[model samples]
Target: MSFAKWIGGALGWSFGGPIGAIIGLAIGSLIDGTAQQGGFLLGDGQTSRKQSRGTHNKRPNYGKQTQRSQTQSGDFEVSLLILASVVIKADGIQDQKELDFVRQQFVSMYGKERANHAFRLFKNISQQQIPTRKVCMQIKQMMDHSSRLQLVHFLFGIAKSDGIVVEVEVKQIYTICGYLGISSRDYESIKAMFYNSSDNAYKILEITKSASVDEIKKAYRKMAKKYHPDKVIHLGKEHQQGAEEKFRQVQKAYEQLQKERGF
Candidate 1:
């Protein structure tokens, strides 16, 4: 119900996001009272003029978290919540299944109690008119390529929870991928797991529409190594199954292409 639940490490919402311009505050713990601070704002509520003027006079120790390990999980959690909210809303209707899917993901990382609490904040996140660019920019700043790829995979699962990945969701995902700096091949590789279309083969192998036979062969070998299900075993069986699906697609696409091109 508060920005407190949305983030941990005491990184106040007001201090975490760009200030002066922030009109809302569900996660409003700004940096002592600076316009440069960005927070994990919860609702439209914002720091009043009095609070922004440094009534507390004490700043959070964002400086203490100089190492990546200290903030990786925190960053991933907040980023996932923001991006998932957009995917859930892509179809113009928020389905219960989509929400449950997201909660399941949280439950895997956090225990049941914490997952439920995060879900409540996620509901708040879903309703907010978040500046997609700004929030994602912060996330992009915190996460690396591996982290970003996992984010896209997790989102793909949510969009497919209702047994269909709608067009709007796909479009929104493409935009988010752009913001997250996910390569087109990487995006399509994940997308193939949920929605396979005419171009899926190229996507599976991370090739191009105009790829030649030799190029396709090389891409297949490379993709096989890259997406080997064993690579994601630590992510648990559920994620392993998803990885398996993608792995199978890469193989199937390879065989199909071989036949199509008489290779």
Candidate 2:
């Protein structure tokens, strides 16, 4: 397999995780010659770079894109970075609120320091343009079924990072997901996970260490009914798999509580 395929597969497995991503791309420099130009990095404040022929609004540039192929590791990162930058800045101006949100994701994916590096690199890549459609097609070819789903989830997470979703960002992600062969149902599954994870964790397994065993049981029962993977099986095999994964998490959380309290 090529480096791009290896990295994509690794990243798809981790999904929004940085360590695995960095590890996957460890064969060479994460930042390539195409990515080493002057541009606003993740935390480098809002600034523009040199634009392509049609790209008027100036931003930074890691030089000009000589070639564009999502199959190339550099190109793939460039595409993702561009996608992320566009999503975060879709609201007219890129602000600290949005940057902070992306930063937090960086920390989650690669830890604070490495994620910082990723942030910088991503910012640089975003300022430049590669063949978007060609790269998207290449990405679709390499990213497998489950990996594509995870990509949609990452896109959703990025959109949801700032607590408000831009219509453009939403449409862009939807389009990209479509390009990757992700069904509407798959898109919805990821979107629901993003919106639901923040507030839904509590509802999934109601358990406070201080709460009595009765409360725990009640919460589990309610969650079991609500999150039963079987309930959404009609959605299709992909959805059933997703729901099953979620159900496993629910089961694990409940089991942990049971063990802690000796219930």
Candidate 3:
């Protein structure tokens, strides 16, 4: 079943607190009066749940996950909606550039059909008040390290949509990472991709500005190897595409440095 259908079942309950009601309103607003017109997109999700349950029951014993993680993984789309909402609001207002960046990413991954539902979910999510740290804590507990890392990566991309990551945005990502039990350095590395300044190319390549040309080239090569989308191919096509975004940044930084230093 599509992730969209899986999300409707948990929309009102998963978030909890004031935001839970807010999220319910969000979904309700998008889905209102349209059920008769387009019910499939806003399915009650009973079929999706039954299908998922059946699939879980059939999983080999050795590969089975506890019900807890399964529940968490099932909420992946909802979590992204919430987390992306928080990031868009981090700078005190919703910026079109950020929203468009996120929208384009969703469209790229889910295609026009599903991306419409996703964009609606995201659009609605943008209108609510998010409890950033609490939700981050929940995400930390439910999601694995790799998934969290990718979430932060997407957040950074939104933060940088305006050409530079402002202080508040950076602070927000750092705070979320802290709550997520992720290392600050990992956030820093992702941050480098979006915000470039005087010597940012060097930073992106993880090399010193004063380093020898040979050393810079070596650093670029190493970064390319490390960030290649292939490194994350196991995560799924969407993630592989997102990784490609980071990989492109690495390539661009290297090329810019190469031009400046005549490498």
Top model number, lDDT: 3
lDDT values, one for every candidate: 0.63, 0.49, 0.66
Writing each residue's lDDT as its tens digit, candidate 2 over 40-122 gives 11221111111111222222121333232112222233345655665665556666767777677556544575466667666
> Cα RMSD (Å) between model 1 and the true structure?
9.5
For model 3, give the 10-residue run with minimal summed lDDT: 57-66
Runs with alpha carbons beyond 4 Å of true place in candidate 2: 1-79, 196-263
Provide TM-scores for the models. Answer: 0.64, 0.47, 0.68
Regions of candidate 3 where Cα sits further than 4 Å from its true position: 1-25, 32-34, 37-51, 54-74, 197-235, 248-263
For residue 62, give model 2's deviation from the true position in Å. Answer: 24
Give the per-residue lDDT digits (tens) of candidate 3, residues 1-263: 44344444423224443334555678786554345444333223564355354343232222233233443322455677788888778778888888888778877875676667777777777777777876776666655665676788888888888676788888888888998888765676677776657877777777777989889878878878777776654434655777777788878888898899896
lDDT, residue 70, candidate 3: 40
Order of candidate numbers by TM-score, starting with the best: 3, 1, 2
> In candidate 2, where is summed lDDT lowest over 10 consecutive residues?
44-53
- C-alpha lDDT of candidate 2 relative to the true structure: 0.49
- lDDT by residue (1-263, candidate 1, tens digit) is 23332222223232354321232243343422222334332211232222233321333333343222222333445567778988899888999999988888777656676576557657766777767776655555544555567678888889999898888999998998888778887997888866658877877788877999989989998888777776654333434554566678789999988887899
Cα lDDT for residue 91, model 1? 87
